[model samples]
Target: MNKIDLTITDAFKNKVINPVYLPYLNNETRTQIYFGGSSSGKSYFLAQRAVLDVISGGHNYLIVRKVARTLSKSVFNEITKAIGFLKLTPYFTINKSDLVITCVNGYQILFAGLDDVEKIKSITPAKNVVTDIWIEEATETDYDDIKQLNKRLRGKSLVKKRLILSFNPVYQTHWIYVEYFAGKWEESKNCYSNDDLSILKTTYRDNKFLMPDDIRELENETDPYYKAVYSDGKWGVLGHVIFKNWRTEDLSEKAKPFSMFQNGLDFGYAADPAAPTHNHFDRKNMTLYILDARYCYEMTNDLLAAEIKNMIDRQVITCDCAEPKSIKELRQHGVTAIAAKKGKDSVNFGIQWLQKLQIVIHYTLKEAINEFTVYKWREDKDGNVLPEPIDKNNHIIDSIRYALENEMAIIDRPKRDRPMPKRGAL
Candidate 1:
């Protein structure tokens, strides 16, 4: 330990952390969870807390993520930034190579990814008991990972033994939601603290230091489902969801004979993610089996084509015809991209066609499950619910429509004018 003594006043803490997080500075809860929308400053405040905890002395802290490689730019960097912002740089020895920070007063902060089990086992605090374990991106870690880490806080210490977690709630089925949140969280509330646990929900609105351009970007986002989860910090989807017709199951074991296997693609860029799906159609039973799917942001046409190619073994892919150049690019990249037929009021027809069929999603298809949970009817500017579904956050669903457009047209046509079922897959 260094000879010099260092301290941070209440005024200094108030200056460093957002006002909403001030109350939690000295909170003694065993478990603390801070989750919400993007740019809410929860991680920043907690990062500041990690530094403050170091200055206060008496305990060791562990900062972690699901993947070891991701910590350098995320949780580890956040703490370093916080230490700089709080003007405590000289008092701590930050070992960037090992990602270990030691305070002058004998306490230390360590980082490890849950994937590196041996590294976690080898890391024991030299001075004090490991009093705090901060799991960044807690959503990526499952129950067993947390359970294993939880066992590390066995012995007693001067300070409260704490499990501090931070993340953006992406899906409802995540073990974090089931374990600590489930029925206890409410969309309207921002803070909840009990005798043993503290859960704080925040969003961009809570971040005062955010730039106007960033706020405008979040405001301009049209995807209601993602905005609810990433912008408003809502757990799962929040809206009048369109479908109760979908369920998850392991399709490989119980799959029945299907008429044909098809794939679909929806073009998106900037705020919207490019989505593509592989599915099986059982024409006889009117069931659509979602086999594999993927969504990516900031992906170019070439990358999307390569991704689609990897997902399929040279299957015909129906895609949104609005971007002919992208379709052409896919072809150039060796993807068999076919333009979907366009028709008047096709969105409505396609949605209806899907509503008429039972959609079975494989348990591994997370993106589809989240989209289906939040896809809702479009609302007018006056807030009246319209007859049509919203176009936002339905990239996979839209791709399905595009892939099965001809079939949807069959369902759209008057029954008397409908043609006999084709014997093959689309």
Candidate 2:
């Protein structure tokens, strides 16, 4: 076998990829998991390592995400970047139409997604065998998909085989954690042989290439939950908490209410609480200002209705759809409340949508602030996060999600028409 020259190897040795990953460059572990947070350079290192494997000859590699449409922008680009970094562009021919890169040495790298099963089945490698696979965002895929992918690693191969998995620890109960970290695959009828598994955890701190502002942004993360997961590279317990993207701000004086607004209400009796939320959306900027809230336990539906009238009168209120009786009762008492449109996957969809927006909870909504810190998803006996969340600590989140999902329809009214504070007020 021809060896890469010392000069060409320097391109890889010098800060091209983080040194934290250098030790595992030639790792033979059958299953290698690189789990971490944003800007950890995990994907970048994997790209460089995989390209090196191709250059070493006698190998075919498949890089995948959950959806095929995202391949061109993510893994494909990463591999091309690696080629440029290693100055190997002249030695490799990129077939953008097929999303494949072929090396002069008969090695090929294919990029695809699991979503398109037919396309994945049709992939043929021009090597000894398809010996290496990288599953980016492995959490998005389930065990069934992985088992099928594993079957492709058959046939004679000179190079060691590897099924590399990389993803953030977003959901603790995801199959990757269940099979790899917790080691509870017995009942699931699947297990990894002890000798073949290697797990590497990393975080933004591991990558020294981050800029000063990037480090500052990560250091200044105020959400305790996100700090533990993204910054420290720890697994967040599923069904534990949901809103790690928010923070408390004094909106009592800073944000004055505008005409474009909505409210949500959740009714409860006895030990349970009835919570209501007043929310305003800055549509142009995609910011949600949670202005105020009403939270009280052992309050009658009538009393809650009266409070809603005084606090968020005449505004369109979308309450928990499950409680049509309460919605009717609130309307009877002159509170403009309607049932939220609950359809299939509403909870997860609403949660995912809220995950994307910039949410600012006013300091005055103390109850909401408290709930945001503890709101969690529901988990099965195996600790897998269920699609639905636990009923507790979610009245505020429920109210807020309902308000946002329902109010988002009015976003087309034109942002300029919505009353904004005087230029200097904020």
Candidate 3:
């Protein structure tokens, strides 16, 4: 193969830099999400952006995916390709064993997977801490993993902190959607200011580098759902979602106070995640606002109880009826754990009740928002939608159902001042 000129001006002359990403070249927002259809030049532009950032000032970029093992073939290759294309390979030292590129100027570009938390935690840059993070294929990663990555963007750097997420718009319930597109949590108080966020949408039509064959293949796609989400850059409507009636909105703090507050827990096994949600319900309008959520894998009962205690001590926690032993253990630990009433079709019943009400979920409750987005009704072998939901992605939903049982009970009972759950009782 012949040598390719890898100068920034040359790359621009060749139109390798998509004009749509020009706005992102600046440090306007702390968080920027670049989402669009396949072959949209999202990755290439991001890799080029990484290179520019490394060359800009005292900045080191950490590129990430969900799985560490898969980074070398995908994001790693893309970054290196951009580096070589820029013809700046001579200024950088590539360490194959460590997957790091260190520049003579002391800036570095590191790659890691979120799955290996320890590796991510060990990344100490030669200059300052990581100033920028680019998460490719971001939909494959979870909200908590992104939280973990956000912590790394600190420590002695004068560069403006930035987290760039680039992915195809996959599910409507993904936190990326709720935070950027849905505008659900824009008003809810959070650590970061929403004014510092930027979202850019693009598609293959905006990319001049795509081959004619690739463009034809994408244009020929016939599936209505896939075309709508992947090609058109829209939030997916999965088959027949169970919670279609619900929407995400800004729950005004000045509105009527919530009639009730409760906690819900759904335990997990092995790779499955355990989810606990803190909820406040508006009985007059039947709007339930998910205040908070904790989702993790393989958490011990004691640790789970401790986490719940840290959030709200001695609250009435309604858990999965099947986990009575876990509940008893929590009670032993001074938590007010209770069992949700369950009978045949309890899941269906709870879902039906939720459907009748308006659910305004906080963007911080990423677990619940993600579950609500992809939780769809089952489909029969004949391609028909069934009445029941698929078993997957229900950890948070199950917790919500158990917590909503308190709502069901208030239907027949009169309102009374039950003392708030005791704090610091663990």
Identify the candidate with maximal lDDT: 1
User: What lDDT tens digits, residue by residue, belong to model 1 across residues 1-426?
Assistant: 523466577887777678888988887898899999999999999999888887777768988887676687788888899989999898889999988999888889999987689999778887868999989988767678788888888677878799988999976766688889878877677888789889999899989899999999888766666667887888864555678799989988765565477789998864577888888877778888998876655679988888898988578899999999999999999999999986766776677678879999998666687678768776544445566677666989998888777665565555323332232211
Candidate 2: tens digits of C-alpha lDDT, residues 298-412: 5567878887888877888888988888788788889888888766556666676676678899865546765676676554454455555566668878788788765544543
lDDT of 3 by residue, 1-426 (tens): 112233466446356577777666765588887877888888888887787777755678888887675678788888888888877788678886788988777788999888788988988877778888989889877778888888887777777889888888877656667766675433222113357776767788888888999889888865555676667666676776778666655555732475458789888744677788888887887777877776755567887788788866777888898978888988888878899886656777677777778887865455567678777766555456556667877988899889888676566223222232232211
Among the numbered candidates, top TM-score falls to: 1
Misplaced by over 4 Å in model 1 are 1-5, 26-30, 36-39, 51-83, 88-163, 167-177, 182-190, 194-196, 203-238, 256-259, 269-271, 381-383, 409-426
Runs in model 2 deviating more than 4 A are 1-7, 10-12, 183-194, 238-426
User: What is residue 102's positional error in candidate 2, in angstroms?
Assistant: 0.8
Q: Which prediction has more favorable TM-score, 2 or 3?
A: 2
- For candidate 2, list the clashing residue pairs, or say none: 239-377
Decreasing lDDT order of the candidates: 1, 2, 3
Which residues of candidate 3, in runs, are more than 4 Å off?
1-7, 10-14, 184-194, 241-426
Question: In candidate 1, residue 10 scores what lDDT?
Answer: 84
* lDDT of the candidates, in the order given: 0.81, 0.75, 0.74
Comparing 1 with 3 on lDDT, the higher-scoring candidate is 1
| Deviation from native of the Cα of residue 2 in model 1, angstroms | 8.1
